[model samples]
Structure formats: C-alpha cells, structure tokens
Target chain A: MKLLPWDYGVRNLLRAPGRTALGAGGVALVTALLVTAAAFVRGMNGSLAETGGLRNVILLGAGSEDSVERSEVKAGVAGIVAASVPGIEERLGVPYVSPEINVALVVNVDGQERQASFRGVTDAAYLVHPQVRIVEGRAPRAGELLVGRFAAARLDVPDERLAVGRSVDIDGRPWTIAGRFEAPGTVLDAEIWCDAQELRVATRRETLSGIVLTLADDAQTDDLDLFTKQRLDLELVALPERGYYARLHDFLAPVRAMVWTTALLVAGAALLGGIDTMHASFAARIRELATLRALGFANGAIALSLVQEALLTAALGALVGAACVLPLDGLAVRVSMGAFGLRVDGTALALGLGAACGVGLLGSLPAAWRCLRMELVAALRAD
Target chain B: MSALVECRGLTRVYHKGDQEIRPLDELDLDVDEGTFTALMGPSGSGKTTLLNLVAGIDRATSGTLRVEGVELGALSNTELARWRAHTIGYVFQLYHLVPVLTAYENVELPLLLRDDTRRERHRKVAAALELVGLADRHDHFPRQLSGGQEQRVALARAIVTDPRIIVADEPTGDLDAAAADAILDLLGALRRELGKTLLMVTHDPRAAAHADRVIHLEKGRIVAAAAATS
Candidate 1:
C-alpha cells in the first residue's frame, strides 16, 4: 500500500504548535530533573573519594570507625606509631604524621551563630593531606585560624567576613584569621584549622580525635593491618583512608536513593501526562486517519507516522533540558560532611535523550493503534 | 463491455446492543468496465456500504464480491490494501485532505507506496494537479484553499496513482451549486477521457444526471435501474 512520506509527521507537529510546545516542555523538565539527580550523586561520590587517598591511613579508637568526630585515641600514640611502624611516609627526614583534635564549635560572625568543624593540627598535617593548598596568606599558629574558602559559605557568612586579618569569636575566644586555603574537591574545604595544643587547652580535651598519616611507597593496607594487630593493647584501629570514605558513602546511601526516587516519580508523571495529551490529539484526527486508510495506507504506516511526530516533539524537549543542565556543571552543593561539585557530563545528556525518545514512542503508539483499529466506516463517520 | 465489479448476494451485518443491523443484505449488482454509474438512495439504504465494499476498505460478511477479477472477500487485509492502492481511487464527501500537508504533498501520497524515484513522483504529482486545474495552488495547505479548491485537490490526489476505478461518495455533498457542478463535470471527464470506471453514491438527483446510468436503492435492495437521460 501507499506509505505516508516522512515529512508528513513534521508537518503534523507544526500544525499544532501550542500542543507541541506543551508536551515538549513537560519532557524537558523531566530530563533536567534526571540529569540533576545523576550529577548530584556523581559529585558527592567524587568529593568523598578526593577527600581520602589510597596511600593514607586513619588511626581511630577501636569500634569508632563510623564517625571521626566521635573517635578518640591517646595524643602520644602519634609518636609511638611513627617510631614503631616500618613503612611510614617521610618527607625531608620528617615522618608525615599529624596528631589532630576535632571539635564541633559554634562561631559568631556579624551577630549570627553557626556551627563549624574546628580541626587543630600541626605543620605536619599539610604533608599528609596533600589536597590542601594555601591559596592566600600563611598557615595558622597559636591564637590564629586558617579558614577554608568554602567554610565561609558553609557558615552562611560573606566571603569577606572570613578574610585574612578578620577576627571570629569561637567559644568565647577571639581568634584572628591568618589565611585562606582550598582543598580542591575534598570535604576538608568546610573546616576551620588552628593550633592543636591551643585547641586542646581551650576545649579542655586531652585526647586526640584521630591521627592521619601517609604510607610509604609500596606499602599496602596489610602493613597497617599488621601494625594494628601487633599493638592490640593500645586499643587503636588502622583503616585505609579509602575504606573510611567508602563507609561514609554507605552511610549516605538513603540520601542518594531518596533523590533518585523523587526524580523517577517526576519523570513518570511527565510521561503519563504526555500520553494523555497525545491520545486526545490523535483522537481528534480519527477521521483523517481513516481517510488515509481508505487511500490504501495500512494501519502500521499510520501508527509509525504518529510515533515519529511524537519523537520529534520529545527531541525538542530534550534540547531544552540539556541547555538547562549546562550551567550546573561544577556547581557546588554543601552537606554536613563538606561541599561537593556536580559533574554534568555527556553521559547525563545521553540518558536524557534515551528517556525522551522512549516517552515519545510509548506515549503515541497505543493511541494511534486504538484509532486505527476501529471499523473503517465508523472512523470515517467521526466528526 | 466486460464487467469489472460483480457483487453476488453480498451481505454485511453488524450488531448493536442485541439488535442486528444490515446495511447491504444479500444484494447483487454489476458494473461494466469504463462505465460511469451512480447509486442513488436515501440515508441508511446501503449505498455507502456498497461503495466501501467495492473500494476494499470494508469486507462482506457473506457472499462473493469481486473487483477487477480479484475476489476481495478471499484476500487478507494487507493484500487488499495493496490491491486498493493500485486499483481504486476513493473520493470522500468532506474533501478529506490532510490539513498539515500542501496540495502537492497530499496528491503525491499514493505514489510513495511504490518504488518511484523523486523525479518520477514529482512529474506524476505535477501532472495530476495540472489536470485538476490546480498546478499553481499545489503549495497551499488544505486550510488555505477554498471548499471548491479543496475538492479539486482531493480529486487530483485520487487520480495521482492512475487507479483503474474511481469511487466517490457524495463528492459534491458539501459544495455550493457552482462547485458541485464543476466537480461533477470533472468526474465525467475522468471516465470519458481517461477510461477510468466511475462508481459514486449520491442523494442529489442533479448529481445522478451526470452518470451514464443510475441505480436506485431502498431497504438495502435495488428497486430500479434506468439510463440517466430517461
């Protein structure tokens, strides 16, 4: 039988420009939501990985692997491990080991109070955590604090409020901002760093929260596992830094699931709405389809033409959605742990196109079939 | 003249809520090749039903129906469609041109089913539009054309495939007298000049006058047959 030309579908889409726009808009919104959700998951995972490195190891009190803030070990254990462990990373004859104290302290900036992680460390902390770079000003000493660039944002204060030379009140003590540092793509970007000894005296805490150290080249997790087993009486646990973040990622699984579920629900609703609109549109043209059938075009051909029309509309919607996602690449999102940047990559665009085409075909095919299945005379009688 | 369409006791029955409706009940009829015949009847008298069966768009519930020596009742839906595309050109009462397509594109539709090249399709579509005196209006959409112009475009679409038989159901039903007369004259010319068989259903007596012969139907049965001049 005679087949309808490909241009027929395009012409039909333009005939009802308003409906086409509405359908396409719905599809575009769904695509944007899906892409955003995917980007968020990617950013969160990447930031967690960047915060932890393969050769680094964290030493915490036994049975406190879930949270570094709650974990504690004797402050003197840092020196003991450095002298005992054989494969400890050393720079310029100095072992790269940092004894740290983590305290959740409230800071007052411009009459506003915000909670922030206060990390107290020594000069050796910079050697173990290489992601940290002092972008402006020097490192902090006693009575001085080094603020992360993102730390200001996390505190809901202006960037200039945390500038070098400004003073911030932390737990009734005024500390001068010595400098600003950036830990590119790491959770450390959301913390305040200060002198460990001063922090211990101010917080009335004698115990260190954790010790961070770098393993020597060719040293594996087995080396730390042997160290921890050899000194079980110390009540210390050694965990590969990668394993630490992987556990944190597991803790945040529900958040990722919730985001994905919400995205899917929105996308599903958009598909159903598109199908309803397409059904009504094709129903109104029943007589015209029957006329095509009478002119020797088969039912399959008519259905295919309708599907092509719907896909074209969806493709337009996908283009709009991809445009919306363009600005979100490298956009930062803050959570309790740290700030992470979203990666809106080509994979997200590819997934959006697939979903848009699926919505287009699934939404239009059934409606076309229903119209074509009616008796020819009855279809022709439709007004 | 040899018979091109033969309907022997053709019956079509449908049921609606415990009641059976028969539009064409055991009806028998014949039309010669290249003849211009009109079926005149009141509403629900089976005129349109007979035309649909002859055009291969509908099937007979029982009895044998043959068009151009092909037993239509025996062919599957796909084969019947292929046969209709090459054999019959159907004209509708409402000038059912697709609103989205230009007159030239609409007329070129039937040729797309075949393996014709772009140049061949263009040549055929251009000639059909010219024959219907609409070559200049080929680029206009159905909505852009007047009722008379739309009907002429539909006529051009029908003849574009060079079908052997042309079946028109009240081709002039929606037109004014001027347009109706023009459409009737065009149908007559297609039969006389191109040797295409013509089978049309109409309620208007003036429209029947254009046919070489007329058959009157009542209650799904043929009641009278006469030369239109009589």
Candidate 2:
C-alpha cells in the first residue's frame, strides 16, 4: 500500500481472476497472430536473402535478370565461365561453378496435379550452395532424384511418398528418389534436384537455366564484366546473386504487404477489444482509486499503479504467446517459389513482446486517465 | 490552547445547470489543539462539507481556512495534497479499507507518502494496529474482518501517519451499540493519551458524548455550541 508497491498492482490483477485471464488471453492471441505473420514473412523473404550470398554470382541469358527459372544459357557455359572468369572460387582443385537447369512442371500427386520446381545439379552445386545438405541417404546420381525436405509439402504429396526408393514420374519418365536433402532457409527446400544430363534428356531441352558461381574472397566483378564483354556472341548477363534476390524480394512486396495488413488488422481488433475490457475493469474500481487519492496518493501515482497492472497482464500474455510460438522454429512453410522454415529467433521474440507491451500501454492509459479525471468526491461516491 | 484549525468566512458552492447550491456559507469556526470536538446536524447541514474542507480533500469556493497556521485556500492543489499527507488523519464511515490490502497494508498507506524506510513503516504500522487492538489480525484483509474490526483498521490507517489532527466522518454510524461504545472510548483515549486534536462529524448523539465540545449546524450556519455532559 505504501507507494503503491508493485505487488499491489499485481494483486489487483489477481483480484478478478476471470477478467485477468480474459484480458491476458486476448493479448496473447493477438501477439500470436502477429508473431505468426512476421515469422511467415521472415521465413519467405529470409529464404531468398539467405540463398543470395554476397560473393555468389549468376550468369543467365540476356534480358532474363528477373527469373532464374526462365533464364537459359548453353549447356557448356559452366566450363566457359570456369575458364574465362579468373577469380572463380576453387575448392579442392574443383571450380565452385554449377550449371543448373530449373524446370517448373506439374507433378501428379494422388491423382491431382501440383506445380513443383526441379533443379538439375551436380556435385559442384553443393560447393556453390553450401546451405544444401543431404540429410538422409545420398546425393542423386544418374537416373536418380533427390527431394528436398519440404518438397512433399510444396508438391502437395504425402511425406512418405517422396522417401528414398520411391519413384516420381517427370515428363512420362519415372525417376527414382535416392535421397532427402535440406536447405534450411532457402527456396530450394521446396524443389527436387537431379542429374543435369538426365533432366536434359528427360525434358529434351539441352539448354541450361543458369550457371551459379562463388567468387573468391579477394575477387572482383571486373573480370566477370570482361568475360561477358568477350562472350558477346554467347549472349550472357552476369549479376550478383544478392542483387537478383533483392529484386525478387521487391517483387514480393505486395504479398508481404498483404500478410502484414491482415496481421495488423487482427491485432488492431484485439487491441480495441482489450481496451474496452480494461475500461470496464477500471471503471468498476473508481471508488477504490478515489479512496487511494483521498489517502494522499497523487493522481499520477494511481495512474502509474493502473498501468503497472496492465503491463503485468501483458507480460503474462507475452509469456503465453512465446510458449506457443517458440516451437515454430524450424517449422516448414511452403510458398509459391519454394519453402522456408519458420524461425522464432531473438529478434522475433523481442518484437512480439514489444508489441504486447505497446498494446498494454495503449489500452490502459486512456481508461485510467478518464477514470482519474472525475471529481474525487463524485468518484468516491460512485458505486 | 492555540487553535489547530481556523475557518473565517469559509464557503463551498456547487452549480447544477445555473442553480447555485451553497453547502457551507461563510462558516466561521475554530478547533483548539488537543481537544475532542464533534459537529452534529441534520442532512445537508454542511457538516460533511466542513469536514472535507478541514481534511484538505476539497477546496473552499471562498474565504480563509487554515490548519496548523497554513492557509488552505492559498496553497496549490499539489501543496495541499502534501499538506494533507503530513497534517491530517481521516476516517470514513464505510471504513474504506482497500479490499485487496491486508490490515497492515491499509495502515501503512499514509506512511508510503513519507520517506520512511521499510523498517520504519513496519514499526509504525505494527504500533498503529496494536493501538487499535487488531495487532494479531494484521494479515487479514478488510473483507475478512467484521464491521467493527474493519472500522478499527480504518482508524489505524488514519492515525498511522501520526498526524496532528484526526478527522472522522460518522466513524461509528455503521456499528452496533457495544462496538460504538468501544470506538468512542478509543477516540476519547486518543485525545487524552497523545494530546491530538479530534474533529468528527456525526448524526448520532451517543457518538458525540465522548467529545469535549459539540457544535450544531443548520443550513450551513452554526446554530449552537455546548459542552458534552460525558
């Protein structure tokens, strides 16, 4: 009671256990929605950003900077870039360059067709994209296919259907699934990877989609510029991988906006509901607050006590939201392009807690101010 | 003895849609230090209004009201609040002990405004609760106590600040005869033992018997003053 100790506010919250639970529940639900939406954007955009390493570069056909899937170069362009580009990173004497063929095709799953991306890669693809790791079985060889961990979800197929020893038909040709791979935070996790030659023969398209390369730490883009200039007949465009993904991220702005707008509206609705509830709760305590005021407590002190109570409730709500959201870390979420894992990292957790606190402060102060502004005698006389 | 409270032409007015209602009109009064005095009157006779003004919980619309030589009308709202914390102890008819707080916490409410350390607050709250004969029930909340016990707790809170003047508004109005006698006896003991000034407003004549002096009011004017036979 002295100085309205913090526990006084806390005990007041417990005085009406039902109301506290309802208020805290409302806050928790809103916070969960907020964290879920943010984790979704974080998972989607994070995949692209993580995949686009700063030192990596992509060589595509002329006039195809936007779509790596649609970009096409000659099948032999990988060797040409390895030889022409002087700073191509070397790993164990092998150049870190991968000539990949990306095919977006419809795959039949349980008699229904679902669109999926298939990438044609070789052993050097692993060196160029280190995020990709074979978590089960081994890498795909000729006549074999490797499915990403989240490929089943992206393809709308049963998880066990894409396991090792299963077969998937691509363009009327049955390909054996030899392994399962995981690319933790990349769009590639929603695709299948197979031998480039086998995919070329199966699709009967000999052209490669693009060539990805890792530049040496001390390397510069000037050499790649010169290479593109010298290979004018090849009709190639060299671009930094990060810049390419950055442009793609910009293209996905509308989708991110949609997600954010929906999330905020939900949170706003919850906030208004919470404010109304808190207003009623504090209104019922008008005489109590007036009594404190009569006992020499300043209006500011009583208001502080009210805010402290609200904040304590919100903190409890945040704790509940965190308990529900932290498990979402590493949970796979499928997107149109590929799949990425949801992550509730420290930043995401902090953001959720901050949003809950903001709701608490915004929800309680106005109600308290209105209640305290009443004349002390009138308030004390109120039932 | 010198007067602890002085009111010269003290008045309070309220307006209800252009209708002016004067609760206390040019009221002139004085309460000496260490004396027990009671103000009695019918409903709307300005007894509670005068008590509120003296307690510094309400402002006077016009005129001078002083407590311990500080003119209440001259002080700002904030300064008046500080003055009330340091100078006045008020007990309410409903025993307005915060339902959520224990007896000890209610008693310590006034002490929180002061710069007393935790140890000092504990000592004062213990002594005050002991003085009210509820020392063993310090941990009990208001709802846990009977009507008389709750009033005693409220009294403890009022006096815990060790203020110079104690003001009660119908302190024994809600109690039974035995409990009323106990409360009146305690109020009488406070004046005799601590040399404290007591000013109380009451409608019950038996409740006023413990006071040394009783003032009657009618329509915001002092109609008569008399000595208590008890």
What is the per-candidate TM-score for chain B?
0.98, 0.98
lDDT of 1: 0.88
DockQ of each: 0.73, 0.64
Model 2 has an lDDT value of: 0.89
Give the best candidate by TM-score: 2
Distance (Å) between predicted and true CA of A287, model 2?
Answer: 1.4
RMSD of each: 2.4, 1.5
User: Cα miss at B96, model 2 (Å)?
Assistant: 0.7
Please give the distance, in angstroms, between residue B202's alpha carbon in candidate 2 and its true position after superposition: 0.8
Q: Write the per-residue lDDT of candidate 2 for residues B1-230, one digit (tens) a residue.
A: 55789999998999999999898999999999999999999998999999999999889999999899999888877787788889999988888889988999889988999999999999999999999999999999888999999999999998999999999999999999998888888899999999889999999999898999999998888999999877
Model 2, runs deviating above 4 Å: none
TM-score of 2: 0.98
The residue-by-residue lDDT of candidate 1 on B177-199, one tens digit each, is 99999999999999999999999
Model 2 C-alpha lDDT per residue in residues A134-195, reported as the tens digit of each score: 99989889989899988998887778999899887766667788999988888878889999
